[model samples]
Every structure is written in C-alpha cells, then in structure tokens.
Target chain A: MEEKDLVILCIKGNRSAQSELVGSFAPRLLSLIKRYQPKSLSPEDILQEVFIEIFRDLKAYNPEKGVLYTWMKTIAIRLILKTRRLDQSWLKDKTVPIEYSDAIPDLDQILNKMNTDDIMKLIIALPDGYREVFNLVAVEGCSHEECASLLQIAVGTSRSTLSRARQMLKEQYAQMKIY
Target chain B: MENNRKDWRDRLDQNESPMDMGMFWNSLESKIPVQNPGKKKRRFLFWLLFLLIGSGFIGTIIIFNKPKGKIAGQTEQQKNAGVTEARESSLSPIETQHAADEIPTSDATAVISQNQSSSAATAAGDSVHKALTKYQSENISSVTKTANTSDKKTGNNSNDTQIEETASSGNASPIKEVVSENKQDQVFGIENQNIEKNAMSTAHELAQNSMAAMEYLPTLSGELYRELNWNMGYVPTFDHAPKLNQEKSGWQYWMDLSYGIGMAQHAFKTSDPLTQSYLGNRSKYESTLESRLAVWENRLIHPSGFYVSSGLRYQTHITRFDWSKEEVKIEWKLADGFVQDAQGNQIAIRDSAWQQYREMREIRQHNTISSLDIPLNVGYIIRKKQFSIEIAAGVTANISQYTSGKQLNFQEQPVKWNATEELTYKKSNTGFGASAMFRASWYPTEYLGVFIQPSFHTDFSNRMNSGAGYEHKIDFVNIQAGVAFLLFREGR
Candidate 1:
C-alpha cells in the first residue's frame, strides 16, 4: 500500500498498517539515531523511544508541510539530542581558533578513500560540541542558524564550531593516512 | 576546501545502508502496545451519560420536594367567592325592587288572591305616583294648579258627581296603598340588612382563620415551638425573635479591618549542600507588617450562648529579610579566552599562561516579599451577656506573591556586586495555608463591636519552589485589635 494510505490506517488504529509504517522508516531513523546517540545510551533504546513518540503523535501529523521520512527523522534527531542534554554548556570547555592548516588533507580525497563505517567512526570520535554541530550542519543539511537554535547557542558559535570540526576531521584523516 | 566540502556531501548521500526489515519489525512489534480506541471512547461516553442522568434526577427531586404553602390556595378561594358576590349585586336597581314587591304572602286565604295581587301592584304604582308628585313640586308646581281648575269646570254636571265619587274611592285607595307600601319597604330594608350582616360575618370568620393559620406558619428564625396568638399582644421575645433581630439567633454580618505587626520564622530543607550553606544559620525571627479585612457571618443557632462564625478574609503581609554584612573572597579561572583587565583592556588567555583573578568585598543583602491571602473559616463562639470568645481554624489560599532583592553574582571578570534583581517564584510557590485564631470581642452597641484576635498561620503545602535548590516554609503569629461594624443582618 501507499505511504498515505498506511498513515490513514495507522490513524484509524490498524495494527498491521502501524507495523508496516514503522518497518518502512526504521532504517533511515536508526541511522540518524546512531549518528547522534551519546555513549551512555544504546541505539536500539533510542530507536524504541523515537518510535513510541512517533506513534503517539501520529494523529497530529499534517501531510502538507513535508514527507513522512523527513518528519520522522526530525523527531528522532530531537529526541536523541534532548536525551544527551546538549545545551550551550557543552561548548564551554572547548575553545579553539578557526585557522586553516597546511597539513590538512583535501576532503574530496578523504571521502573518496574512506568507506561508510570509517567516515561514521571519524564523525563519532569528534568532541560532543563539534560532533553535534558537524552532524546537524554538514551532514543533516540544517543551516548554521537552525543548528544554533537547536543546540541553544549563538549563530557565531555554531559557525566557529562547524569550522573547528572540519579542521579536526582533516587532521584525523592525515593521521590515518600516516598510519 | 569549499569545493571539497561540496564533494563530501555528495559522497555522504551515496552511502545508504540496506536495512533488515524482518529483524527491525520483530523488535518494534514486541515493543508497541495494542490500542483499542473505540473501547476508550465508549467508556468516556458512558461516564458522561451517567453524570447527566444523575444530575437530572437530583434536579427533579429538588423541584418536586420544595415547600408549597397553603397561603396561596386560601387566597385564591376567597378571590373567586368575592367575584361571584360582586356580580350578583351589580344587577339593575328597578328589577331588584320589582322582585322584592312580588314576593307571595301566606295570608292569601283571608283575602281574595286576585284582590291581594291587584292591591300589591296598586301599592307599587302609588309609590311611583308619590315620587312623581315630589319631583313635579320641584320643577312644575303650576301644572298641579291647572288640574284643579279643570276639575272646577266640570263641577255642575253628572261628570262632576262621578269625579267626586271616584275621588272619594281614590282617597281610600291612597291610604291603603300607603300602608301596603310601608310594609314592603320594611321587608326590603330587612333583606338589605341581612345581606350586610352575612358579609360582615364571613369577613370576621376569614380573619379568625388567617390568625389561626399564622400560628402554624413557619418562622424565619426557625423557631418551631413558638405560637402566634392574636388575642394577646405579641411582644417579640428572645426565643422567637426574627432572624435579623440582633438579640436572637440569625445571620449577623460584620466587616473588620485590622493592621498589626507580627514576627515570622523561616525553616529550610534541602539536599543541595551549596544552597544549604548559602542559607546557613539564618533562623532568626523577622518582623512583618500585617493587614486584613474580613466580612464575617455569625449564625446564632439559638438564644443560648453558642454560634457558628464563618467568613471571607483578605490579608496582606510584608516581610523583610536582611542578610547581615559580611566580607568574602571571590575567585575565577579562565581558559583560552579574552578577559577584561582593571583598565578595561582585553587580554588574550593562553593555555601555557592560564588567567586567574581574585577580589574581596563586603556584601549586604535585603529581601522583601509581599503576599496576598484569602482565608475562609468556620468556628464556634461562646458568649456571655455582652462579650464573646471564638476559636476558628481554616485554610487560606495564597493568591499572589512578589519578592524583590539585591544579591551578588559572578560574571566574567570582577564579581558583580549588589545587583538589583527581581526574582519571582513560580505560580506553584503560593499554595494553600492553614490558620487558627482565638478572638475575644466585646459588643458596646448593637451594631458595633471591638475585638482582639491572636492567630497562627502556616503553609500546609510547599509554597516555595524545590528547584530553587532549597525548600523554605514561613510561619507567623499575629495579634490584631480592630473595631467591627455590623453591616447587615438576615432579619430586621
């Protein structure tokens, strides 16, 4: 059945339709959760929570604004961020200048050489503040202002943090190439 | 680097992981709880129907069981009877007089029946002739004189002799007619007097019945044993006094406005060590200004000394707290950042050379909290002749609260000293409080009284926010003296 029909049936309290909807969206949502999940929480646990909230609030869904996958992914990302308590205080300890380095490798070369798991591991190894900004701005395609509001920080801080995260990723790739 | 960033995004999109749907479905299916929306809606509708039916049944009972007095029924019957009697009395006057004259007499055997009827009819005609004579004497006396002259014209003929014989017969007829008319007039007058006497007797009986019914009527003061006797002068006694009677059992209202000074003690409880240390040894009782206006209703259940008093009271309390002057040292450690020096110049902080600052200053803090509370209470009063003692306990709802103060905080460089901050506790900060008071009042006049009340009040619920890091409850004891004016009473 189509996604719209599945949503209507889900709203009507159809168990099979609800299960189908969950099954169809689970992969993309789990991947998003894996990117933002803190060390303390399991990906499966976060996915379970995300699906519970999605079903609970399904009745309030308006289809005119966006597609189902986009809406569901937004819910997953917000829940993961809230569970980690990623406020502006996360940026307090780490302060670095956004200067370009000669030793940094080209991002295109690194992306071409790296597999999906290697890239995911590199993004995960970033600092809590850098990883959040990089994932939201660089990977999730949110604007710097949007990332600032989501993380409750200034727009300037969000720009500087994204710059610092890119530099750190280039330095990590240089070290991997040396190894 | 910008070109590399654009290429990295494209590469990131190209790497999508294939998902195992069966495994994910099995896990999610186990976690999702089954929902029965129809059953939930039906249950809600059932309760709503039940509530509506219950309220309707209660309304029906109340409407049907209400008191319906007999006063309306008695007045309606009297009105109908009066209307009938008035209609009968309003007939034409001539018809009623003729009816009176035609009443048959029992002496018909002594005289010819036809002669008796003719004589009664002639008597009525003679009365009409006498009325016409009196009316003609006023308006046309000359006409009578002319009739006498005409009699003289016919004097010497047989017609004159015939007139003389007829006149003589009419002379006897006039006397007999006068006697018969007098008897009929006497009978009509007796009937009129009998109708008036019957009406007066009915009126008298109605008045007696009304007075008897009043003896059984319910009194406004709920005095069931008292009887109203019309035969005796009804002086209002204390036992059967009206509800508004100040000397008896009824609702009495008074408005009292009072202002006084009180002392309050603060008790703090907290799990946070920093908040606990911040409020250390601050257990001293502080003075507060208290003002209250209350309208009280005292219902005296009987002529005896017991009464129940309840009312709405509005009170405002102003409490001041002064954290005494103390000297303290402040310290700050800054990492790689820009800091302002005493000369207001920015200096960069490096990892090798960490920036540190210290300052010492004396701090004095003052806080004031104003609160408005509305309390409702019920209590019993013990009264002697002109004095009463009352003990009341009730809950007060704290409706509004405001707290303003000057405190110290640490910003980037130097500690901000004595910052004026308006701190508002949450709406949950004001909760229901309990109070108990003892009042001794003396009534110098029927409408005025003086009283002194000592009251103890404390919040039964946590009136302060737990998220403020420390929980604090305040209690106060106040002794207030004020004059009360009796605004109204249930009965006059």
Candidate 2:
C-alpha cells in the first residue's frame, strides 16, 4: 500500500514484492558501497550481491533498527568489510582498520576541542597500532579491554596507546594554538 | 588534563558517526520510483490457506484412528472374562449375569463351588494356591460361621442353595453352600464317595461327549516350558539383593540379558609397603572394586503351555586407578660403616658410618571377583480359555557354574582363581524354588488388546559355599506396556 510498507513486506519473503524493494533501494546501497571501495568492484555488481545476501538472510535482519534504506546500508557495509577481510592479499597489504562512531555532537565542540580538519590529519598520521586503538577506544568509545581483545594486544598496551594518541593530539592542539 | 581528554574523546566520536536516516531517506524519495505492489498480497493468503487445510486433514485422520483399545467402553464379553470361570460356569443365564453385576458373596460362592471340584483336579499348583487364597480371603468370616455348624454335613447344604431357585433373585447363598459343602467334604471326608463318584461321571462324560465335556476344561491345553530372567535394582539394605520385579499382565515372557554395575569398598590389612606408603602412613588401604556382568537371563518366567528360554550370565568386577605402583623404591644414604670394601681391610671412618641402612619394602595389590551362572526354569499354563488370569510358577536348576567367557580380570589377564585352587563347592541338591505370574489381556479385536499385569516373585539358588558365595536370589517386580498379536489364538 505504501512505499516503505511495501519494501518491508517484500523483505519478509513476499516474492512478488521483492522486485519493487530491490529497484527502489539497490542504487543507494551500491553508491554507499562505492564510498568504502571505489574501483575494486562496480556499484551494480556489489548491489546485486548485497541484494542476494539480504534475500538469503532476510529473516535475520531486525526491522526495529531503522527504515529500509538504512537497513540495506548496514548490510552493504557488513558485506564490504567481509569481502575485504577474506581477500588475503588485500588483508595483508592494506592493514587498515574500519572506523565508526556512535555519538553525534555540536560542530563547535569538535572544532574547538579537536577540529575535524586537524583530527583527520592526526588520525592519518598516527602509526597503525596507535591509530587502530585510538579509533576504536577514543572515537568508538569501546572499553580499553575490548579494544585489546579485538586487536589481540594486552590491555596495558591498549591503555598506553590510547593515552599516547591523546597526548599527541594535545601537542598538536597546543602547537596549532601557538602558530 | 582529564576534562581536556574527555573533550578530545568527544570530538573524535563525531567523525565516525552514522548519518541521520530520518532526513536521509526522506530526501532520496524523488530519486527512486515505486515497483509493482499488487501480486505480493495474493501470495500471503495462499500460505495461510495451506496451513489451515493441512492441519485439518491431520486432525481428522487422528480423530478417526484413535488408539481403539486405549479408550473403549468395556463390553459384556470383556467384563465377563474376568468374572471367574468357576462362578460363570455354574450359574444359569439369569443367575450368572445377576451375580456378575453385583458381587454378592453368597451367590458368587455358590456358582464358583459348583465348578471348583472339576477344575481343581487339572489346575496348576499356583492356580490351586490362588483359588485357596481367594477362597480363604473372600469367605474367611463366612467360613468361621460354617465352623460352628460342625464340619460334618457336606451334601445337606444344597437345601439352603435351593431356597431361591430363580437366578435373578441375586441369590449368592447357593454358591456359598456349594463351597461350604466342598469344604465340609474335605475336612470331614464324609463326601469322599461323592467326589469319587463325580470323578467317574466326568470320565463317563468324556467318553459320551468328549468335546462337550471339554467345554470349560480345567487343565492347560498347552505344553510345559522353561524361562530364565535377569533383573537389577539398587539394594537399600545390606542384608539382601535389591528388589527387581517384572510388571505382570498378559503373556509375559521376557529373555533379558542384565548386568549389575556395582561398587563396594573394603578395608583390609596388607604388609605390602607400596600400598602402605601411599596410603598416608595408614596400615591398611581401603580399596574399592567395581562389579559388572556380561550376560544374564534376567527374566524367564514361562506361563504354562508354550515357551522355553535359557541363557548364561557372566559377571565380573573392574577397578581403575590414576597412580599405582607394584613396589616402592627408597634410596638411603647411610653413615659410613666399619666394613671392608672388596678387600678385607680396616678403614678409618666417621662415627656415623656405623649406622645401618634401613628401607621398608611394599607391593601394591588389587582384587577382582567373577562368576558364571546358568539357570534353567520350566512352567505350564493351566485352564486355557476358562481362566482369564494365567497364573504360572516353577523351579529352575543351576545347570552350569562356569560359563563360556572369561570370568574376571584381576591385574591384566583373566585368572581362574577359583579353578586354580581346589574348591569344595557346597553343591546344592538340585536348587528348587517357585515363582507366580498372572497375565490378563482383553483383546477387543483380532489384532489388538489391552494387557495389564501387576506381578511379583522371587528366585532361589542353593546357598553357595565359597562361604562368601551364599545363595544367589533375585526378585523381580515390573509393569510392562506393549502391543501383542495373536499369531494363532485357539477359539471355540
């Protein structure tokens, strides 16, 4: 009956309604995939694979989380991460950690405390171990113990690395202020 | 520093956050067009329809094919089977039905005693016991009344039975008088002539009309049979084996192979230093032995007339340990002694050298026991169709003390400990004992029936003489639930 209502029913094993659901959301999901990986795979190719995966595991998705577009977006992100991790050559050479955060704050607080332009530069400059722990613990607000377990490091190392990242940030902030 | 770090942490969080979806999806509406929406609604209704139809079909089949005998109204034939053949045979149509409806003791007794004399001669021993028990129980107080009448008048009691000739009067007095007459005849031997005369008449009845006379036959029309049973249960009392009984109901003949997995602890003194040393300086080590059996006929109680099953039972005990030693090793560094080494020359040594070396020798030991038992039992069913309850009891002979398999493993290999040493086994003079089992099954149809049996009995083997090998007695009490088919049921 309704656009959003139609996609929800299609995802719940209503076969005839699925084409409508895919046509509406497939392009946006593909574009989101393009942001994470630009040229390795086509948006159309990734989108098709994502729809197949979604259809196969439709019952597993929790509807209460968000609307159809947001739900499709989350599935695309998980599949992208999975594809990259499983490609041994890419995994070995890339050595990069995915980043995500749960909090949204005022632009003033971010800029005054650790400005976005400077913060991005600092993150790009930090060493692999330091950057990974910094992103997970500081940016993502994960516990130091959780970061250690996920990164396969000692809790003490996680704490010290996070502390060092903050120290470096403060030094940069101080230097920028002087300049 | 803490506030600055918290602020920096909060600033880092803003970069990795997800987009606000409420506004994102709304903005993208014009970019994506709607797809076909009609066909999807039709499919949902189909699934609902299929589930409803499938469940209804299954419910109908179940309703039509309900376990027929599990819940059926007791018919006249089924209820009449257990009405005591002796009572049913003596009473005419009106009397039998009346007595069966109401268990009037006097009328029922008259009907039972009328046919009791003929049945008694051919009945199995247990049937006789059951009849005696039922008679004693049902008419104990009434029998006391007869005791005052002097056990002399045997046939005169028929006058009391004739008081109400009509069967519908619910007259139990006639049945009671008949039983009393038989009792009188037996106690005073006054009517011994009449009983002999009836026996002759039966012989004549057999000659004149064999088939008609055979109509309520007392003797079991089947052959003698044997059975062996194996049973196991936890023995709460130390004085005896646990009670393991079979559930009685219907033709119950089971050939079971049972094993008793038991653990027993014993404390005994040992001079072996290995066990003594490891036993925390204790003089004796309390060791436990586990027992097991290979094969045993747990139950072989054959109801009279057609079954035979015998098998061997091998039993043993096994023990397990984490750390054990056969001998203890101790290194003693003794003080120098005034003794010659190789050559007989006096040597100057410290005063402590004269101290003698001392070591305690110990050896670890374990014990295991095993036995082989073979029992042969035989029985026969009495009063075929006339008796609803098939009562059987018999004796079994311990045919073989040694079975085919290895008896027990003590250390590593099986040892014939009992065989190696000369044993004066207290051989029993043919072990004799009895068991009683009652089976009653009501078959409403040719293929199915409801069988119920609540039975209990015990077995007795001669007291063995290892001194420790006392009599092996096993008792069984069980209730079995199963469906049986009459391969060939004899019908009149």
Candidate 3:
C-alpha cells in the first residue's frame, strides 16, 4: 500500500494496516536497537517502546515530507541518544590506544568473514564513549560536528573518540582470530 | 584487499533477518492506543437502526391484531346518518303528526286540513296553518266587539256569555256588527261540530298515506344487509337501491408458503484476455436451480385488493462441469549435508541431492451456493367467491449467502499455468433486486387456501467482482405453489 494510505488507515485504527506497519518495520528497528546494545533494556523491549512512540505521535507524521523509514530511523536514534544521556557516560572523552593508533588495523578483510551480529559484538566491546561516537560518525556516517552536537561534546573529542573505537574493534578482531 | 567503508554501511542498512511478523505485530499491537473517531457514532447509529426496525415490526403486529370492528360499525353509522339527515331535511311522519296536533283542541272542525287534503298533506299543511291563524284572530275580535255591544243592550243567554269570554281573552273593543255575527256564529258552531268528526277522520287517513309514501327512511335498527367476513371477495360494484349490500372494509392478513423451480442466467467477463478464455464455458449456466422455497410470508391486504407482503426466501445455485482424468504430481528433495560430532565439528559429509515424487488423477468437482433473502412485495388481488388472482412487483434483499465447496485448477489443461489457482466467487449481504409476480389462489375453506405464484426475478449483483473486471447478472423465473391461511376478518 502507499505510505499515504497506510498512514490514513493507521490513524483510523485499522488493525490490518497497523499490523502491516509493524510487520514491515519491526526487524529493521530491532536491528537499530541491537546496534546501540543498551545494557539495561532488551532490544525487543526497546523496539516495542519505539513503535508505541510512533503510534502515539502518528497524527503529526506528514508523508509528503519524507518516507516513513527515514523518519522512524531518526526517532530511534534520538531515543537511543536520550537513553545514553541518562547514564551521562557518553559525555566523557576516551584516549585513543596510542601503541595501536600507529597501526589503524585494516578491518575490511576480517569484516568480510563476519556477519552483522559478529560485527556488532566487536563494536559492543568498545568503551561507551568510543562506541557512541563511532556508531554516530563511522557507521551512521554523520559528520564529526553533527556527532559532537548530538552527543553534546566538542568536534575534536568526536574525532579522537572514533579513532579509539576503530582501534579497539581491531584489537577485538585479532583476539577472535576469525581472520 | 581493501573494501569501501560505505559498503559496510549499505550492508548494515540492509540488515534484515526474517522474523515472525505475526509475533512482532501481536507484541506491539497492545502497546498502540486505538483512537478510532467513528466508534461512538457507529454505536449510536446501530441503536437508532435497531429501534426503527423494532418499532416498525411491533406497529405492524398491533395493526394486524386489531379485530376488524370499525369497518362495519363506521360504514353503517355513516350510511344511517346520511339517511336520517335526508329524512330530517324533509317533513317526516312524526313532524307531520306534530303539525296536525297543533290545531284548536276544542273544535274538531278546525282539523280543517282534511277539506283541502290534496293540497294540505305535509308541505301544504304549513300554508293551511297560516290561513287558520288569521281567520281565528278576526272571528275572536268580531265576537268581542259584539259581546261588549250586547252588554250595553240586554245580556241574556249563556252562549253570548261564552262568546264574551273568547272576546275578552283577545281584549278587543266592542263593535255593533259583532253582535249580529254572534247569533250566526252560535248556529255555525253547532254545524261545525258535526262536520268536525268527519274532517278529523279524513285528516288522519291522509296523514298516514303521505307518511307511508314519501319520507319514511330507515336507520340501523331497520332491516339492511349484513356485513361479509374477510375471506369472501368484495363485489366490484353493486346497484343503488334500498336493498343495497355493503362489502366489509378493513386490513386483513394471510400467511403464505411456496416452493418453486427457478432458472438462473449467469454472465461473467474479465479484463485479462487469457483468464477470460480460460474461464470461458466455466461460468456458463450449467443447469438451473434444484428448488427455491419461501415460507412464513405475511400479506396485509387492503379492502381495495391492494396488499403488501414480506417473507423469507431461500435459493440454491449449483455449478457442475465435466472433468477428464489427468495425472497430478508432487515432488520432494534432500540436499547435501554435513553431520556434526559431539564438539559441533563436522565429521561426515554428502555431495548429492535426492528427489521423491507422488502422483494421482482426481475427477468431477462441483459447488453449491445457497442464499437466504427477505422479499417485500406490493400487489392487487382479483378475487371471486372461492378463488383469487393477484399480480404484484417488488424487491428482494439478500440476508445472507453460504458456499460450501472448493475449486481447483487442472495441471494438464488447454491454457497455460495461471497465477490464480482458484476461481473466487465472492458474495455480499447487500444484494437487492426487484421482481414481478402473478399469483392465483383457491380457497377450500373459509380460512385456508392454496396458491400458485409465477414470478420473474432479476438480481443485479455488484458483489460479483471477485476477479478483475468480472461482472454477472442473473435472471430467473420461479413457479411457486403454496398454501395460504386467512386471518383478521375485516368485518362481519
């Protein structure tokens, strides 16, 4: 169905249309939550919360502006960022492992052997500050300045934090010995 | 070897693992608040519709149950009142008697109408009364004047004394001429007594003859024809006479049940030329319906032969086609696999695939579609003493339809494989159409009868669009035979 039609039906509380929306986007949103890997909440629980918020604010949605997936992704990113601020840990700046920084490990070879779950596991091992900064900049492809704004930090810190996060992923990759 | 970092972003964005969609929907559906705006409106409409239909049914029942009393009473009262008014407008017998009794009581000769009996019956009596009134006043004044003069002269006899009393009652003055007339009146008065007896006899006879001849109208207490019961047919027109018979007038009810043989004409079309060709000869009118039945129909008949009827009708449509035996095949396969040991390390391996097959040929597929409907009809009846004929037209709305059979596609067929595996015949509850009917009935008893209604029904179905651009129209004829029970006698 067209997104306009789907949104109209969802607002009218059509069960089939609401189920269709949930079915089409549930796994993608769950993957986004898994990427954040919140230590306190299950990915499914967080995904449920995301859909609740989506339905609660469905009237404000305008299909003409952009597609639903892009809008939903922004909502998930903002919600994860808000959860991180509650811990107040993502605000700290972590030092890049200097000995390893000389060799920014080439991860493209190891990444080829890995599925997204394994890659996520490697990402999860990094410190909270490095992981948040890396997910915002390197994975999500946000500019260093935008990452600093969202994380409430300086551009210099985001740049340094991403390097540390990538270096840590490399060390974890070597330890796994999959390459 | 190095890969573009953007490649990982694309792969991660496409990170979809097949999950149970129903499970996720169920888990999330509860968290979403339902905010349908029409819920309250729909509920209010439901109650309003229910109340309207319920009130209509109850009102119909009460109207039908009311015994047919007023039709006869009201008609009789109106007719009688008209006759009475016409009688009163003219001088009736009792009024003429009252006019006759009003003349001078002491003098029978003053029953003066008999001498002019030909002109003095009822209408002429009014003129005669006026003339006598003048003559009595003149004679009394002359007597009074003569009595006063005779008092001035010699007042001798008792007869003159009575004359003075008549005069004194009028209080007229004495006159000389009145004295001479007093003697003449005394002799005339004696002669008037003899004549009065004969005049009274003749006047009484004349009054009786006129009373019997002209304006003796009858009321309800008088003999008129009796009102007929409901089952009897009404006369179209009757002659105007005193003995005219009145037909009963009121609302009556009849219960009817019928079974009919109906033929359905089926038409089907499609936008897809290929599907059309394949579906060709499949949707043809394979055979007519087995039977159509209608029961518990109540007809409310008006005295003028117009009626409204409503009932539940059930119809069935069956599709049968010739099927040739053909082989149907099913296949299965086992792919190459590696067996794992205790530590989850593969130890055994296979390098090839296995295939299995099963086959059979099945024949003869059929489907039956049955529908229940409520039909409302308005008709006019032509009836005699024992039989009635009615012609009517009306609409039938579908209450429900049920189909209890399956359809299949043949593997070895003339057409190539199609995406749709089965023909989906969808039916809806809102089907409505009109019909024309001609019914004839024979009553064996006063309250029970049998009837045959031959009907032509045309149903236009917008609900037939189960496939792309498919439309169907059905024309059927039903020759229905049934029994009828008459109820609620309009009048007696």
Candidate 4:
C-alpha cells in the first residue's frame, strides 16, 4: 500500500498496517537520527520515540506542505535534538574563535578524498555548539539567523561557530593527507 | 563558498543509514498505547434527544385531548338544565289545577304565593316566576276573577265591595257611558236582555278555560324567554338584567402572560463533505424554555359565536445544542520574512519550516431568540354563562428577532478551535409563522378573566440563516396558563 494509505489505516487502529507503517519509516528515521543524535542515546530508542510520535500525530500530517518522508524527517530531527538536549540554554556564549589560515584546501580535492561516512564522522566529532550550528546552517540549509534561533545563540555567534567548524575540518583533512 | 555549502548540504540530504526494520518495529509497537473506540456517549445523547422530542409531542397531544372532555361536560350540564325545566313544566299544571279548586275558599292566593316562594329559591325557578308575572299583567280578567272568588269565599266580600266602590268612584265618567248604553238596551226589548245574558254565560265559560290553560302557558313562555336571552348573547348578571346595548356585537380586549418549553430542529444542505459530516455527527438538538406576554383584542363578529382577534406578543425562545467533537489540524507555511529579535536584530528566516498543531474540541451552544410577534387570529367562541372557550388559528408576523448564541467560526485562518465566537443571526428578521391556541377562560367579573391556553407556533420561514452550511427552523408547543384582564368590552 502507499504511504498515505498506510498512514490512514494506522490512524484507524489497524494493527498489521501499523506495523508495516513503522517498518517502512523506522530504518530511514533511525539513519536520520544517527546523523544528529549523540552516541550516548541508543539508535533503537531514538527510532522508537520517533515512530511513537509519528503514529500519535499521524492525523496532524497534511500532504500539501511536503511529502510524508520529509514530514517524518523533520519530526525525527526535533526528537533527536530534544533527546540530546542540544537546543538548551547551556550553549549561551560558548563560541570559540578559530585562527584564520592563509592556505585553505581545495573543496574538490576534499570531496574526492572523503566518503560520506567520513564526512559525517567529521561533523559528529565537532563540539556540541559548533556541531549544532554547523548541521543547522550548512547541512539543513538553514540561514545563520535560523541556526542562531534554533540553537538559542546570537546570529554572530552562529556565524563564527560555523567558520570555526569549517577551519577545524580543514585542519583535520590536511593532517589526514600527511598521514 | 555559498555554492560549495549548498552542494555539501545536498550531499548530506542524500545520505542514508542501513538498519534492521523488522526488529525495530517489534520493539516500537510494544511501547505504543492501544486506544479503545467506543460510541457509548454518543448513543446516550441520541436517546436523550429522542426522549425530549417524544415528550414534547406527547404533552401537546394531552393538552389538545383535554378540551374535548371539558366541552362534553359543558354540554351535559346544559342538558341537565333542560331536563330540570321539563320536569318543572310537567309538575306545574297539576299545582295550578289544585290552586284553581281552592280559589272559592280564598286558599288559592296562599297556594300561589307559596309556589312562587318555593320556585324563587332556585335561579331557573325564579326566571319561571318572572315569566308568569309578565304573562298575568298582559291578560288580567281570568287572574282577577280567580282572585275575587277566593276573597269572597274567604269572607272578604266587604273588602271586595269596598275595592269596587273605590274603583267606580275613580272612573265615574266611564261608568256614566256604560249606564247610558244599558238604558238603550232596556228600551230595545226583552230579546236584547236575553242576548246580554247569553253573552255573560259565554264570558264565564271562556274565563274557566283560560284558567286551565294558564298553567302550561307560563312554563312555555318561561322557556322561550331563556332561549331568547341566550340567542341575543345575553349574559345574565346577578345584580340586574342584562342591558339592551350589551346584546350587540362589539370589541373585547384582554392581556395574557404565559410560559412553556419547546425543542429545536435543524436541517442542513451543504456541498462540503467535511461540514456535512461534522454536522451529522456532532449536532444534538435539545428542548428550551420560553415565556410570552401579549395584549389581544377580539371583535365579536356574530352573536352566534365567531370572532376575529389580533394581538402583539413579545416572546423569548431558547434552544440548546451540542455539536459533535472535531479534530482540527493546522499547518503553518512560513514565508521568508525579517522579524526583529529581542536584541532588535533583523533575522531572515530562509527555510520554510512546517509546523503542525492539532486540537480536539466539542462545542456546546445555547441559542436564544427574542422576537416581537403580531398575531392575527380568527376564532369561534363557545360562551356559556361565566365560562368561555376559544380555539384560534392564525398567522403571526415576526416583526423583529434578535438571536444571540455561541458559534464555531471555521472560516478564519489560524483557527483557534477552543475559543467560541458570538454570532448574531442577521437573517432572523421579519418572518411569517403559523400558530394555534386552545384557550379556556373563566370570567370572574364583568371585565376580568383567568385562562389556560395551550398554544403551538411554527416558523413558515427558517429562523436561522447562518450561512454556516446548515439551515434551522423551530416549532414549539407551549401550555400557557395566564390571567386576562379585559381593558374594554361591550357591557352585558
């Protein structure tokens, strides 16, 4: 059955369709959560919470705004952020300045050398504040202001954090080449 | 650099992770709570609504049925009165014959006085005596002879002779004309004297026969008088006779106050399936209490009991409804705009984030409609002595209706499902309606009465023009007990 039909059946309390709906979305949601969530939280636990929320609020979903996957992805990101406590007030004024480098690596060489998992690992290894700002602003296509509001930090702080995160990635990439 | 960032973001979006979905589904399904779908509450509300409508109809039926038995009782009472009159007439002739036999002994006067006194104790009997007195005054000779013979047999002959002498002295000129005619008869011969004696004997026989007929004559005349009085629309007063002017048809005015309970019914036609479903599932109609005060004037069109009445009434009707539960979901599509932060920095929101919020709410509503009604009714009145009953049917023109109620406003964007909006029914203005009333009244005085009226009214046009995908019309049955004070009436 189609995703929308499965969603409607799940809302009507059909058990088999509910299981199918959960099966269809759980792996994709777990993958999305794995990218954003802390390593301390279990992938299964985060996926469990996202699926529960999806079934609970299935009736609230409108296909007009976006597709079902995009909607569920948004919910998964919110749950991951909330579970990790990344959007809390503790990130206030935590931005660190990065020294500006004269010779930056070519983006094409960096892209060709690293796999997607390696790039994801590089993002996950950043500090909580830098990683949140970097994910929201660079990966999620959010503006600096949106990233600032989402992280509860100043726009200038968000801008500096992303710059510092890029510098750190460049330093790591150069080191990797030397090895 | 911006293009490089965009390319990296696109790359991140394409990334996916590999996981075992079957194992994850088993764990996730175990944690979700199961919901029980039951319609117990909805079923209870439906039964309650059904009972309310049923009771309203039953009560109206009972009220209409009551008047029939009461009318039958009134007819029975009239029949009993007629029987009593017939009995009196049947027994009266025997009493009159006995009085005639005692006339020579002067016991007839005593007997007649005794009979009149006995009959005077009852209202019907008193009317009978009055009718006899009127008849006696018109034809005096038979009654006068009987009176004279009774006096002579009682040894009051000297008193009778004195009465005659006094009468002759007062009418000496007529006595002289009678004496001259007698002398002319004497000069004519013995034959003329024989003719005079024969005429005297005939007059004596006629007087005897008239005395015998007088018994039944009084009873017939008495009954005729009562019939005439009733036909002339005369309501006999305890203090005196009904006046001549009161017999004519005229205007009667009174004021009435009433209270009752009624129910509301709704009919809907909509092209929107959602609206139709919501209305079908959620709308519960309930009974409402009402009150009315009015002043009416009836023009008695015929003495045979037809009248046309018109009144101005102010009435208030309340209708209660429970709308079905609805789940509302609103999706906000944010546009890119600059909003000043707490620090007064303009932040551009480039990403259009979709925020989905849902609410479940049930609407309970009370609609009160107050209106001024002008009713034009034509009715037939059955008037009996101090009581009257009128059954009237008419059209009532609603001059103005002011409706105040809680309504759900779904058309406004950014819907607040929990908040109720006050709606005024603008189309509730002048609408024509039909009404029927059964009024039973008792006149305690000449110009004052108390009445119990069971009335029903239904709108010819819809009472609500909400344009909210539903049309509503209301019909109500009201059992109103009220007092009527006649402001002006033709005196009788």
Best by lDDT: 4
Per-residue C-alpha lDDT of model 1 across residues B268-312, encoded as one tens digit per residue: 675532233334344233434354545454443445534555556
Model 1 segments more than 4 A misplaced:
A11-15, A38-42, A60-66, A86-92, A98-122, A137-160, A169-179, B1-15, B36-492
Cα lDDT over the full model 3: 0.51
RMSD per prediction, one decimal? 23.6, 28.3, 24.6, 20.1
In model 3, what are the clashing residue pairs, if there are any? B145-B174, B145-B175, B146-B178, B146-B179
Q: Could you tell me which 10 consecutive residues in candidate 1 chain B have the lowest summed lDDT?
A: B218-227
lDDT for each residue of candidate 4 in B1-492, tens digit (9 for 90 to 100)? 556655656666667677777776677677564332322233344345446544654564466446445434533443334322433454333233533343232211110111221211122223333444554666543443222222222223422311111011122211110001012111100012122232233323323343332333322322332232112221145343212134567777767766665444444444433343334423434444455656565555457667788878888776665454333333455433344455433344444544332233444556777878888988876665676777788899989877777764232223333446775754565799998777777777766677877667778886555545455666665667778776777735
TM score of chain A per candidate? 0.87, 0.47, 0.85, 0.81
For candidate 3, give the lDDT of residue B422: 41
Q: Write the per-residue lDDT of candidate 3 for residues B16-90, one digit (tens) a residue.
A: 656677777788787575442311222233334335534543464455445556544643453333222422344
Per-residue lDDT tens digits for candidate 2, residues A1-179, read 67556757755556456656665565556444534443233334445556654554353445565555545555565455434433333213233332232222332244455555466554544444565666666654568776665554678767766666555545454554622
In the order shown, the candidates' DockQ scores are 0.10, 0.03, 0.11, 0.10
> Model 4, residue B379: displacement in angstroms?
1.1
* lDDT, residue B303, model 4: 70
What is the Å distance of residue B262 in model 3 from its true position? 72
What's the TM-score of every candidate structure? 0.38, 0.30, 0.31, 0.40
